[model samples]
Target: MPGWALALPIALLTLIPVAAVIGAALSPQPEVWDHLIRHVLPRVTANTALLMLLVGLGVLCVGVPLAWLTALCVFPGQRFFAWALMLPLAFPAYVLAFVQMGLFEFAGPVQSRLRDWFGSSAWFPEIRGSLWGTVLVLTMAFYPYVYLLTRNAFVTQGRRALEAARMLGESAPRAFWRVSVPMARPWIVGGLALAWMETLADFGAVAVFNYDTFTTALYKAWFDLHNLGAAAQLAALLVLLVLVMAAAEQRSQRGRSYQVASSHCQPIVLRGWHRWVAFGACALVFAASFAIPIVQLVLWSLSTWREELEPRYWDFARNTVLLAVGTAFIATTLSLVLAGVRRRHADRITAWVVRLAVIGYAVPGVVLAVGVFIPIAWLDNLLIAWLRPLGFEGFQILKGSVATMLLALSARFLAVAYHASDSAMQRITRSQEETARTLGLGSWGLLRRLYLPLLRGGLLTAFLMVMVDVMKEMPITLMTRSFGWDTLAVRVFQLTTESMWENAAVPALAIVAVGLLPVVLIFQRAERIQGA
Candidate 1:
């Protein structure tokens, strides 16, 4: 087979959108380089760097200690706290941004209660629309990326190493700092890389808090100034920022390998200050990151009126669920096939194509939208032209349909599904596949009967991950939804824009509530797997 033919589909689809963006970046009569150099770009880059750094440090602070305590200590509700801290992963940054803004806005319930308690104009803490507030919101929503990765490392680090450190006269804290953390550095960096990528990609939270970042600037350039080229240039800058972070992360993880346990090693049991301290710390972290936002959203949702609760809202709810489910299923399915195909082929063409497919996760939703639109629209027009010869009407494969949304979702989320399946496949011994083949089981039979069953959990987890992502998705949905169509994300976006906090709260909470279902399922599944 021709190499390009094998690679062309994924490569062409992926790059067409990026090419369109570059084309736009080049076409604005003259580049906006002068304006960007003088004013917007520098400030936006600085703020973006600041946000990424703060969020990175915050996650390390909360996630590392929390993971260690849970892994080593016997605290009250340790398992509960361990899982609950991850609950924030289910909450979208945008929804949390709205919740925080609603609570702390000048006229919000927090200030209102303070006014009623004291005299008018008495002191109340100013939090909303501040850098601190933005950091808190992002940390709350994105910390789970770090928390889960770190905790898994802590769990797998085993007791033998720590015991050896203790035998050598190392204190528990000293042992953890010197032995545990250094060994787990790769896992920690991987998680931090994921979190930082999310932090940079975040648009809704920073935009709502009125913090100037690259995404916000790009949006403004496109929507407000009517300059696609300027938006593309800004996007290119953001891409450069991401690439720098990626390089640093790669360097940090270089020459690190986390080998599986050589033998069963009992973990240390906790006592004294260790247990209580662990409990207190985890409780505070969980309460701030997950519990607070969920409770606040639920409270505001309850206060919403019956008349305002339109039945059409349920239709939107259904739409959101179906879209998420369909997208997750199709994306996961495609990823599994692609991952398997790449493994079997072991060729640069297939490997690079799969890599390119996964690259969509790093591309911001708005960037992905622009990339997808060009080919989809062109294909629609081509089909229309082709059908003119017959009496048949024009055909549109993707434009303005749920199909288009699903395609975008698959492209954007393929990484999550691919990684999940790939990891699970790695866990199953290669000997199994070899043995099955020796027994005269054809590749089809081997995959169908053996590999499929083992990977079911990973595939399901991937589906849930993608589904949650699709539920929280905003930018692409906003850009691509057909006229008169709406999802809960869109409703929340509209209400937030109109400054209708109460109305926004309804759908914001709805999005989080619906999004968390898969999270709950994943937790239960993980528990079962651990127990087994």
Candidate 2:
């Protein structure tokens, strides 16, 4: 079969949400547009841009130095810190937001204690609804994107380059700024690009902090204003913003090559106070980002588990599992199909189709939810109109089920599964396929007998990654789920929205625990890369 047979449908499916958002935007809603332009757009634009700028700077500050220290320096606990620095990846930004807020909010322990001790406590910096605190939470949650990419770049750059710079009489710090960092510009840019994308897509964390950005604006438009068209228009703007950023990132790396020799990287030995200073920096970030938040989450969970661990909580867990597991199976299977098509066809059209199909990863969950719901609502209305004469009344079959949530989630995360599958497919040599064909195996036979066995590990990884992502997802689950289908993420959102931070912890802890599954995979892979 031609690749277009599969690739076209997949690409079109991926395009549904974008098309919906764009189409909704084109239809003139004068009142909504006027209101947004006059009142909402100015603040939203500034807030979103400012947040992006701060987060961009924050991640670079937090990720680049730590990556350099971990990859190219010898210090106490260097091996442990290499992986420990990335532990924050297992905590969703929203979870961290609530944990931090709980600690520093007016009634929370820190401020309350300060008030009691001082009888006034006017000097303590407020955290709830504070922009800087939101930035801190987001940076900690997202820095791994930069660290993972930049560290790999640094690792691949052998010590010879640094030695060359040193022999030219350049000081260590100066040489690092001049040579090492510039060589890793592409990787750093890519990492920053990923961080920007997630920051743009974020909702739960900002929502918890009561900070306003495009996501929160779009959400309020949809739910608070009871206006779906307005929400769609806002989502369209966000979609365009993401596309521009992604295009810029692609253009920046277009003609750049940062490849280095395959020689092993020998770390620079730290002497005296510098050794402890390096250790202190890495330890501080790890502690602030991972250790504190986790310990607080545990404490909060312990305080509330008695009341929160009832049967309804199980329902939330069950709902979370059902959505995650269902999406994982869907995404993993589709990823394999797309990967197989790309491998077999190797045509320009097929490659483009696959790329388009996977762009859903950059689309925000809230945007996906709105874009996806429009078509389903339309279909449901049509169904209701047609079936009313047959006594099918008072119900929306499609809109009243889990199908829409699953579709939005699958669309949001299929790119992740596709990348994993594509990488795995690259590992299978053409010779292996040819040999299998010579043994009288057809395409289906080869897939069943050869590809499946070899690709099992990668597909499994894709499944787990997708599952964990879906579990932690908030906006899609919040906006798209049918009534009574609340998952742990949705529960966390609701409780945090109500400022019940302690109540949100049980579910938040569960998500963090599940989030560790992919983190372990990442750690193991990084170790393998380092070993090689």
Candidate 3:
């Protein structure tokens, strides 16, 4: 087979969507472009950039210090705080936004209570419908990405490097700035890249809070104005932005590897106020990230009616579970296959295939959905026409069905699963596989007996991460969900859009409910893996 023969399928798969985006871009609409450039594009672009910058800085300020403390301190409750800080990842961005808006909005309980207590003349700070409010909500939801990556990087660095800096007469803080941060830069930046992508892809929260970014604008164009091409163009721009960020990050990480000797596994020691201060800092982090949002969500749910238990609510819940489960399973299976194949034959093709598949993680959900849908629709139309000659009627099941939504999700989320499996695979030495081969074990036997068992932790983590991602996923679900099939995410967005704050609380709580199980499971598994 020729090289193009192998490359053809993937190239065709990619080109179909790029072609659709190109067609949308070249839709002969100078007037639309002129209107956009003259009115909305500049404002949206500026706001988007500002939000990204603020969120990045906010996460760095709040998250990096906490990660360092957790990684290198002997604070009270440090053991618990170390894992619990990751709780923020389980809180969906939109759910956090909804809860925050409820607390801070004018008629919300916070202000209402203030007014009642203070004769309705209290000048409480305004938090909703502002750029800072958007930043606050997004940072709370996104900081975990930064924290986890940076913390892992610090832990991977072990204590030797920091101790060596100390022996050279460097103070703890100065040594940290000089050595630790620079070493952790690649991982931290990768995590920040993910955070930026999440921010770019955000719609439900930004829309609910009345902030306009490219995503919200694209959503309004597609849904309200019925302008699909405009949305596609906006999505194309977002894709370009993500690609640029990815390129920049890759360049910054030109020659880096995450490796450390086992001898440096001894933990660092914290003395005096550093210990107490670390505890206080972690307490503050928990209060802001988990305690506040959970309390607000619970309070809102209790204050609301049971209208969410209605049949329609059940349907949405059902849809949400189906989508989450389907996407998790597909993503896990595909990742396992790719991981296994790569393990068996470490060739350029296998490596590149796996890399290409996981690049979906960097692609924003909405952008990927738009990219996916265009080619799918094009193919459906082409197929329907071609099949008509064989007496088949119109058939386009993938466009507006659970299948399309799940595929889009898997494409966007396979990296989480792949990364998990990839990490676990790294822990297993090639020597083990060679030993198995010497013992007359073939590829299948080695995988079945050794690889699968060793990779269990990764598999579990991957499934949980993908499951959480699917539960909170909104953009692609909104684009491809069938008319009657509303996921909990869609319901939350719709109810919020309609100002049915109480109704939205139900689905928001449901999302929280769905997230907890996997979170607890992942934490337990992570503990065992880390301890081992």
Give the alpha-carbon lDDT of every model: 0.77, 0.90, 0.79
Per-residue alpha-carbon lDDT of candidate 3 for residues 1-532, written as tens digits (9 for 90 to 100): 4333343343343344545665777674787787678887998999999999999998888778888888776668888888889887777888788777877788888888888888773577666569988998899888888888788777777678888898999998998899888888877897788788889878877988889999888878777888777778887788788779888888988876756545433565787877888788899888887888887777768877475688778888788888888988888877787666666666676567556667777776777767878878877788888889887776665679777787788877888888887778789997888888899987789878888899888898888789888888888898877676788888888888776777687788778877777667656765664555
Error of 2 at 445 (Å): 1.8
Query: Who is ahead in TM-score, 1 or 2?
Result: 2
Which has the greatest lDDT? 2
Q: Score candidate 1 by TM-score against the native.
A: 0.88
lDDT of 3: 0.79
What lDDT is obtained when candidate 2 is compared to the true structure? 0.90
Residue pairs with backbone overlap in model 2: none
Best by TM-score: 2
Tens digits of per-residue lDDT for model 1, 176-217: 899888878887888889889898888888877889888888
Q: What is the TM-score of each candidate against the true structure?
A: 0.88, 0.98, 0.88
TM-score-based ranking: 2, 3, 1
Predicted structure 3, TM vs. truth: 0.88
The regions of model 3 sitting more than 4 angstroms off are 1-19, 26-28, 167-169, 255-276, 383-397, 424-461, 521-532
lDDT, ranked from best to worst: 2, 3, 1
Off by over 4 Å in 1: 2-8, 23-31, 116-125, 257-274, 374-401, 423-458, 521-532
Cα shift from native, residue 357, model 1 (Å): 1.6
